[model samples]
Target: MRSLLLALVFALVAPALPAAAGQTLTIAKARALPLGSVVTVGGTVTTPSGAFESSFFDKGFGLQDGTAGIYVSAADDVHATPGRRASVTGTLKDSFGLLILVPTDVSLGRQGLPVFPRWTTTAGVSESTEGRLVLVAGRVTKAPASDLPYGYKFWINDGTGEVQIFVNTQTGIDVSRYHLGQALLVTGFSGQFDTSYEVLPRSPHDILG
Candidate 1:
């Protein structure tokens, strides 16, 4: 009887114990972290909203610390609840301003759901026009009223990569649903507007999922 009681007590107590700390590190671990290494870290996410949550930015965190905290955009559906705990995973790429972790995944811990900013207002368009293949996120500006009607054009700016996104109408994308400020992510051919280039959209969907 005593053996059974002890077994029951152990079973009850084991689960209550705190979870073993996973392989985790701080932003300072960037230099030592190897490429393609999966890691977990905790940090404070700054967001448009005033709230903050204990969050996890994973995988690429180690790579970005050397350069700077990863440059994440609100347009990439990566906005986390302010002060919320989260876990993220992605490839680490070094960029000019900050080390960038091209996040593959992000999860908010016990914190409630996050509220993302809506892409509203036409002034969100950015002026940076460099010829390079890249990803941009921003609000859609008004379509040109002029007669040049080959491809659909809209402006996207995510404070990092900003450009005019031209999607071929042949893809059957409905332009009417795109409001002035609807958040959008544009992944396609990127180059200087004056330079010879092409913009091919991966999909026609709302910026916020």
Candidate 2:
């Protein structure tokens, strides 16, 4: 009787399981996919410098592609570190307006190379460009000043307009790196900060002189 019930349960549930779980998705494709869908995405970890195990993040790191990037969430520990190629399987989750992946499983492959940034102006940074890994070049208008209530962030003006650029403590960047009146070119994942949007740069390499 117990054995029969186990078989019956598996029969009923197996058909409902995702069939295309093995299909590979790029960061851009995954970002466009509908919420709650389970898909495998391939990308390179770009932030935290190494494996991320944070109370706020749970356990995960940032993943990026030539077109875009997204935060990957691990329920527990994350083995994949920055620059490592990751074949990640997860369900798309909108965590309180923040798009993150809840990873079911992740397999690391070859080391990943950096992606070319998508060129765009400050005026072009809109909802359409959200999550895109892009480059915005302009003068440091406001310099390293916190427009937000707090954090290592500043404003950049690409002649078109202004966009906030944020660098986390883990990225090892400082306000001194950005000089006022200097022509600056910065790259990172495009995301939101509160109701306003912001750009996140992972390292100095992102800021071209």
Candidate 3:
């Protein structure tokens, strides 16, 4: 009877196990998920080199994506450090009028190759610039120019499309290495800052060959 009871316990528990305990998910997938769903999001969290704030917060934190800002939960203790890739696991919560993943478990991950958005020059992006993260490949229209105290500004244009790019000083990249008219790829959020929409490249690493 002991052996039979043991066998019954194994049979009852075996079906409930998940096939994949830890899997990576893209930001879009994480955002689309329902609240209370368990998921993992992998991304780099860099220290904000300049001052900026988002509507999601009461007092502005020193972290910002370009000049707009970043949205993080007050419950999370993970502060932004430059050039670090973190894998965070938690439940998806829609709070503070934004979709935020409340991280229950956080761990550092091996930094992978930089990911740049794939965008075509032929597409007109000005009107649809709300909350879009895009990657565009093009020839550098201009070299990096000094913006704020801790930022660099440049422009890139494919034959069909063109956009401005911004990188913060904390990325530790030499903007001089990028030559005008050189082929390059950039990834960043597509949105308006200071009444004009622009692509704020999250990091210098986002620029790829």
Better of 2 and 3 by TM-score: 2
Candidate 3 lDDT for residue 70: 28
Where model 3 places Cα greater than 4 Å from the true spot, the runs are 1-77, 80-129
lDDT of 3 at 77: 42
> What is the full ranking by TM-score, best candidate first?
2, 3, 1
How do the residues 93-190 of candidate 3 rate in per-residue lDDT, one tens digit apiece?
Answer: 65433445556676755544333343645134353433344667788888889875646777778777667776655555578878888998776655
What's the lDDT for candidate 3?
0.54
Q: Which ten-residue region of model 3 has the weakest summed lDDT? A: 59-68
Question: Can you write out model 1's per-residue Cα lDDT over 69-119, one digit (the tens) per residue?
Answer: 333322244445434555555544544323344555665555543223223
The number of the candidate with the highest TM-score is 2
User: Model 2: residues >4 Å from true position, as ranges?
Assistant: 1-19, 48-59, 65-68, 75-83, 146-150
- Lowest summed lDDT over 10 consecutive residues: which window, candidate 2? 48-57
The Cα local distance difference test for each model comes to 0.40, 0.71, 0.54
Error of 3 at 20 (Å): 32
Q: Write the per-residue lDDT of candidate 2 for residues 1-209, one digit (tens) a residue.
A: 99999999999888543446588877788887889988888887765433222222466667776666887777666566567887788899876465778889887777766555679898787777775667898888877865333346778887788988877554555668677887888887677655667777766677777
Q: Could you report the Cα RMSD, in angstroms, for every candidate shown?
A: 16.8, 8.0, 10.3
